[model samples]
Target chain A: MLDAHLRLSSLAHLGLAARSIEEAGDAGIALGEVPRRVALTLRGDGEDAAFLDAVGRALGTAPPLTANTVASLEDVVILWLGPDEWLVNAPAAREDALQALRSALGDLHHAVADVTESRTVLRLSGASARDLLAQGCSLDFHPSVFQPGMCAGSHLALTHVTIHQIAEDPVYEIHVHRSFADYLWRWLEAASEPYGLAVVTG
Target chain B: MLLITCPWCGVREEHEFACGGEAHIVRPLDSHTLDDAEWADYVFMRRNPKGVQYERWVHNDGCRRWFNMARHTVSHEILAIYKVGEPKPEFEG
Candidate 1:
């Protein structure tokens, strides 16, 4: 249970946790967290025009049809999980978007869940970013197969994650559950040891 | 590592799938009407075929959908994969 008066911070001890690699250079690899992002899981019939229209109204864009693709509109990005399921992440708060979705999808046989606190995102970038991830990840990390603006669900070091390529410089975002944050961070650091890792904090 | 193809999520590593052993075993219409021998057959008998076999598999990690697969037990080769309610495909052993 959470304390009523005590403050709660998701990445509270991350600064201290990443102390060893503080002085590492930019040429190797830089790691950081994009904390406090809004995450909402949306599920509905993708073929239903009404459902698509409702989701568009809430997100300002329709969902992606091509599997593992992302429909990014301004601050909101919707990652397609399956034919009828998507994971929407936004930089801003999700109250307005959630309300809009509820009002739009009235009485539909669908599900919308807010999972902001369920997952934590870690940004991995630099020249050796892809090479570093290729150590333990099962999916092919070559830029030719996984290009910029593409996302995929894969297993990294025995943990499930959603990997998104945001830039051609090999900047990738890994979304993992909050419960596995510490373990994944340690695993990433261990995997990136040979290349030398630099921890970036805001 | 086996690479199983999910009907919805395409080809993914076999770690994402769970084998649901044997497929399409119909239960007796009325268990009370059957004698001990017939009841024992329905409960215990299984077609552990050596060549081509029909099996049920579920994509546990990806799409989480269940589907049927025709596989060669000896060689571990997948012949065909179809949906849950799909009819058993007609193929030579």
Candidate 2:
């Protein structure tokens, strides 16, 4: 029996630790959870220079103004969710960044929300990652269109998700609600069965 | 399936959007002077036109932005898509 007081990731109950993961072999698809990351939903005027400057000072990188794009600095990534909304993601240890954002954006007409516990991220990568995602998503994932640094909000297997492509190797980080993490993971596993799914831990 | 284009998120599947009935229905300026019947008409009545129609749509799953759309009822053709607060484009047919 698992300890009741132990902290667990969203996918921890799926027993990924016991599953065999191919780290060196040529698995068609690799799946893993990016656990314990801080997610903040940020809203502000994209056209306001002061708002942009304040956020840039807080995160060391200005939020991407262009739709369906992402801006990254060191370990923090800001994904454009709308014309005036963005999702800021950073490591769990970077709570100082959150404080900096709140302090810097003071008196500005903006909203900052800590949504870390509300959502979980799944990393899907490898040669067959695009193909597997294409089966369930309507967005065009062709190499020319959805390259590195691009992000989009779409539904996969009927679950809402914000997908960010972080690497040219076609690695995609799917941000989904914590409650739907298991359902999406199972769906991905089923969808990648033909291509052979390899589960990894990070 | 209709391919609707979001003002901010570009083109996306129709399932990601929700139609909010007719657009450009202005409320009466003097609401206190209006009778119950007048208020009911403003709140309930919709054009429900048979030909070209202007309507509001929200990108529910994608960017969650609300915008306006012009579509033909019979042909199911989308004529134009514009952002909120923009002037409605003149359409003949």
Candidate 3:
């Protein structure tokens, strides 16, 4: 019964968010660089094939941002949050791409909000990660089927989450509202201390 | 074991959900023409399906949304699972 008091740490002031990007600045974890990336809203026109094609072309076959490679963009990335949406990850320096996308999809009933500070990203690794996750989550994560490249959305400890399994290192990426990040982080940390959680940040 | 795919969350355990019953029971277009007994039959009667059946399920612990699935009670095999609002997909097979 290893129970450490749970503490919710909010990175409300952290400027930007990087989703599960591997390389980020000094903030530790995948902290998005403040004022770094821009969000383009695409509403009235729906998914502009021409715009997407243009973005795809701008990235020049090798998209600067790591595309999800699953359901949405190139099936590599998916908009799990809503219908007619896509999560486009650009390279480390993609300010230009954002502007290009915006101009390309100009005024079609779309509104993009900069959510860099709206959420926090936590990378939970180590074998015990799954054990710790089992404490509150209701999904069957046994490796037999939930292997790498698979992602699932569910409520863990009553908080909505997007869980992505990146490796057998059993590395997990947790994305939640910035306000709830602290609660979930503390909850996971408390559950993983004994299994030797290697807190990751960069 | 049988795997149930959620429209939003993907596949999950069966225990996390509750069986929601059939997806295709239709009521009469002109209900005024039917007697009270006939109305009750349409509203309360349930067909104890023993073979292939279309059922509804609420992934209470998962997506928390209702969905329809086609399964066989005898074999315990789920043929398909779809959103509750959409029309039942045409059985292609």
Candidate 4:
């Protein structure tokens, strides 16, 4: 039997120790990995009241119907991927969230899948975080446009990433495919070189 | 780069979308009854208009929804954007 505890993050081989690093009095950006987050892809008719109600009961909030928006309650966050598709995220080892959704949605012509291993989450924060992301992304990063609570799926450095802005401090949680985790990490590090990059861990 | 507006996700970079060729190309209901040339025309033929052309595009990177767009082939200006099933809007070149 494979030990779940022995599972490692995609960036594990990089040996990036999470330590606070200060540079020239202040660091421009702080990068860290939020490993092992449970992700589930949920698909259902957004216009159906019963479907929405079931999902709401399961996660404590109805999935956001607006495009590129997010809804969260406690540790469960739901991102609208499309008109009828959503991505549900919760803390690590929260497999119960999936079961709760499956049971709640019982034969309601809906689909819920556990996609935890498909992608890894990385938290990028600090004042210069948006600037660093804007270097390669085409989306306008103006505060009024891409504010907290908003999320988008766009290409960053030619890699597809789903970015969720969780704070007014410009803290962003970037979700990228596990296979591209190393490449994105190296890219972020190189990009942050201009603005002192600090790699930290929780 | 073309700034295509996704009906659901708003405006995004053109790279995030994929051009799905000319729109409103309906498949023949009586395919088996049609001859070789007629079948080939249905499969291979597309209007290569120089002026306003209706085209299909999908926001593959963002919402992943297919939408219709009317564009000027010469100027590359988008005239109108509508959802999949909606009737195409009237447009002049």
| TM-score list, all predictions | 0.87, 0.96, 0.54, 0.95
Model 2: CA > 4 A from native: A1-7, A20-24
Whole-model alpha-carbon lDDT for candidate 1: 0.81
- State the displacement of the C-alpha of residue B17, model 4, in Å, after optimal TM-score superposition: 0.6
How do the residues A110-179 of candidate 2 rate in per-residue lDDT, one tens digit apiece? Answer: 9998887888999999899999999999999998889999999999999999999989898999999989
DockQ class, candidate 3: incorrect
Give the per-residue lDDT digits (tens) of candidate 3, residues A120-151: 45666654667777887877779986666566
Tens digits of per-residue lDDT, candidate 4, B1-93, equal: 898889999989999999999999999999989999999999999999999999999998888899999999999999999999999898875
RMSD of 4: 1.9
Candidate 3's TM-score: 0.54
* Runs off by more than 4 Å, candidate 1: A1-11, A16-24, B26-45
lDDT of each: 0.81, 0.90, 0.56, 0.90
Candidate 3 residue-wise lDDT, B1-93, digit = tens: 556776655677666577877778787999989999999989888877777788888866444667898887788878878886787765432
Best by lDDT: 2
Return the lDDT, model 3, position A42: 29
Model 4 CAPRI rating: high
User: Across the candidates, what are chain A's individual TM-scores?
Assistant: 0.89, 0.94, 0.62, 0.94
lDDT tens per residue, model 2, B1-93: 999989888889998889999999998999999999999999998888788899999998899999999999988899999998999998876
Off by over 4 Å in 3: A1-9, A12-52, A58-83, A90-93, A106-113, B1-4, B7-9, B13-80, B83-93
A best-first ranking of the candidates according to their DockQ comes to: 2, 4, 1, 3
Q: iRMSD per model?
A: 1.8, 0.6, 5.1, 0.6
